[model samples]
Target chain A: MPKTLTKKRMIINIIISLVVLLIVINICTVTGTRSISLSNVLKGPGLEPGDNIDYEIFSVRISRVLLGVFVGAALACSGAVLQAILKNPLADPYILGISSGAGLGAVIAMLLPGISLSFLGGLPIAAFAFTGAIITVSLVWSIGYFTGRSQVTSLLLAGVVINAFFSAVIMLMTLIVKTEQLRSTMYWLMGNIPEKQESFLLLSCGTFVILGIIILWRISNNLNIITLGEYESKGLGIDTEKTKIVAFSFAAFITAIAVSLSGLIGFVGLIVPHAIRLIFGPDHRQLIPLSAIYGGIFLVISDTIARTAFGQEQLPVGVITAVIGGPFFLILLARYTRKVSLMK
Target chain B: MNIIEVENLGFDYGQKTILQKVCININKGTFLGIIGPNGAGKTTLLNLLCGLLKPKTGSIQIDSKSIESYHVKELARKIAVVRQEFVPVFDFSVTEIVSMARTPYLGSFAFPTESDRQIIVESLELTDTAQFADRLLGSLSGGERQRVFIARALAQNTPILLLDEPTSFLDMKHQVGIYDLLKNAQFRQYKTIIAVTHDINLAAQYCDEILLLFPDQNYKFGSPKEVLVQEQISKVFGVEVMKGEISEKIFFIPKGNYIKNNK
Candidate 1:
């Protein structure tokens, strides 16, 4: 697309995205197991006199939608930032082995009896996932630095190696777990929106939202120059290495938080950014906000399908996202490959 | 006063020496060209001047202050560099890319002001890319992309502009265009322009001073007439010069196998 047309279309798409998000969230809230009225959903799930839709709307649907929005936004924005920093369209939060590392930590937590203390159960899971992500990124960075001049190729290769290693550990843990534990672990790995206390989701969302906003804002400058390549960015006065570290750490934090809250949701991060870039012409000032919004919308729609598709069978949301996201990703890869070949 | 002063600059990658005992001073508002063959540390010298690389055993002073004393942002405000190649990972419009030159002036969360936009537009016009301001950088041709990069550097509004092989990928027409652009930036804008190039003739045509780097562990830094001599050209490039001219200028063409023809 021409740059001007893309910018104009981006403004329109951003407006459309907001409208679509509201519509999707509303639909998800009203069309769940207990079908509620749209009016009640709009009023929110709080105390309203003479409202028949209080229970389902307030207690169950609101938190679920909120969780989907927060997780989706976190993943998508992080993915966009990661791809820009790495200078690879294929980059995502999972590419650094963060998801697999988190999975291994969660699997271990599930296996050890004493580790699942009541107050510490979910907290440990979240903490473990956060630690795993940070460790994986740091390890990849150090390995890449040690191996060569710390180019993107070395970093990506390190990620692949670490991912494979973490996956092996996760598979081993899965083999040694009990039947019930195995079922729950599998569900967690497949990714599901759990029925957490409202306070927890709120707190998680608050923390991630603040951090995500700050990161997105801070990196906008670096992202602008980074798109022009690392050498040019440095020549343009960017502290490229420091910028990369900050971007990577922020992305890892958001990804780990999303994983801790739900599980291993995929594709939201990878697809939303590409889609946003295609429309927005790769300016992070616009791309970041649009990615956040549309990522939330996309995930909410996918999760709604997961919950209501089979009428209570409750297929994992991750499976739904994969089913939808995989083909879309292939198309994206095809388009990008064509573009790269044309460049050559 | 010399805007840029390099004292005993030496650098090496591990044990492989790149630049050795290089020292030069560039006055403010002078157009200086550093010409050498491949791997002659031209780019390395530019990188050092731009603070992208720290010299191993020398010092670079900008306006009589040690370069290390200036913050990255402050250095950016003083010196801007344009590399030979800029392959962006994503598609940004010409305006967006050029606006990034204002980064050093912006706070962490600040956006570009109206005055910044005016400067960006003026830079785009200066580089003759204002017509393509809304065009995607990736969509432009190599020469057009080179101009866009020059515009980005100009938008920085720095006093010193360092270009590393700015015309490497350009055709003759665009090469002339870029040379004119650099000359204008120096004469009209009063920028201290230092360019690294392999095109000695182009350097001789436009530059106020030429620094000739030879492979024999020596360099000649002087006016184009003093540096672009037949003997120096023959010795440094290892080519016999059939004919040359220095009538208010310097121009040379290589003599291909004059000894073989005589035999």
Candidate 2:
């Protein structure tokens, strides 16, 4: 049996998670090819460009770490909400076809360079990817909602089918694109942590993600009731359908932002929520906030590994996540399934 | 006085009529048992009364207010339902699950207050689930889990409680234990209980009133003795039933072919 989480224990856990996140941020910032010290980072970027190489590298690393933190939090929170509302443990943000749709949108943008000019100086690919994610989720939501008795099951099935179709389209587009474009597309598909992003874009996305998480936090209890299945949720006065709409919209919106920032990062969403649930318990009020914090920590660590492990060549952060997270998730899955079977 | 009044309630799925013109008036604190064979729409009736499903025709009134007029939270405060099965994705402890019942009473940012915590504790004690309060819900036995779910319903602190096949999966001992718990809740807490079950004898033993439903939206509503007649049970259920009394309470035993042939 899982130990019940007391208020004091939960508070301590939260504090520890925050501390770990800070330590990880510092460690990740000081890592990489240049190997800048914490003191150098503390001095901050100098006024003159290129003159203070240490500070410049430090600042760049900090930005990347910040991006990793935001991206991870968004994905994990989205995953937690999706799993609760969908009533499926295996559910992740990308399971809603967000990734495939984003991939397809990005592939189209690459194949046709004319669309890129609509944005001034910023990566229009991110914009296209965000649009694609929103469109795909909306399509899945309506199709699943209007079609039937078991809504979540229908929603999942629709997502899977739509995801397949989009992936196929992306594949076809890749076949015809020029070699240079293909290489970029392949890089994007594998997913890399960009060294720099427009500060405005980063700020906006971070703000939105934080806002979404806060909204989800406010309704955390509702998410808990909704997980008990439809009949029970309604009995608890949840307005289950309304809760689903609100949760689904927020989760998808934030996930779109994360996917737009970093191309199709996997496993953070799928694993972090489960790990948090196992360690701290499954009450959503705690689950949502803890998962977000720990998610940031987990991704920062994984991204750091991605940067340092390959020695300047740099493995895509997504690959590092799957390679590390896949096995860890499987172990949790095994323990989870065994416990369930024992209960029977 | 009637706490729940149903008039000409009709429900159907697409073209198939599941319930038609069902009507009943249940007074406060009444232990009403709903019994039927498969596909008799007993569960559907329970859903409709609780506002989970809307009636296709006619109306339902709770405390003389139209059912549809009550907000979901408002309705929840008036009625609590214990489902047949609860399988949660994340395994929450018994106390945690029961505390969720306080959601309707909580403000947007408020945690469970002192009063709410008192209610949760009281519910666990009442349901004899206090021992399992800290145990994860999945780790408990089926009977234990069912009791925890009942504890949750009790924590809702509603005037009325509805259950759908509350003991269909339990063994005889567990089945008796559950019915006993419901009867106690009805007696001690003065809660109005409406349970849908397939256990006819148990219904006769525990319920003050019985509703017997047949296919095609037909039903009989009356005292248990009036509704659970041997002839009616045999006719509707398509089986042979012999009625008897034990300790002055009515009971029924189905007379299968083996019994008839041997006798």
Pairs with backbone N, CA or C atoms under 3 Å apart (clashes), candidate 1: A45-A58
lDDT (0-100) at residue A141 of candidate 2?
90
Question: Could you give the CAPRI-style class of model 2?
Answer: medium
**For residues B48-141, what per-residue lDDT tens digits would candidate 1 score against the true structure?**
8888889998899999999888888789999988887555778677777787888888886335677877888889899999887876677788
Task: Put down candidate 2 lDDT per residue, B93-193, tens digits, no spaces.
Answer: 78888888888898753367778888989999888889868777878888889999999999999999999899988999999999999999999999999
Candidate 2 lDDT at A322 equals 91
Any runs in candidate 1 off by more than 4 Å, and if so which? A1-23, A37-57, A114-124, A326-344, B255-263
Candidate 2 local Cα displacement, residue B47, angstroms: 0.5
Candidate achieving the largest lDDT? 2
Local distance difference test, per candidate?
A: 0.80, 0.87
Error (Å) of candidate 1 at residue A48 is: 17
Deviation of model 2 at A105, angstroms: 0.9
- Model 2 B-chain TM: 0.97
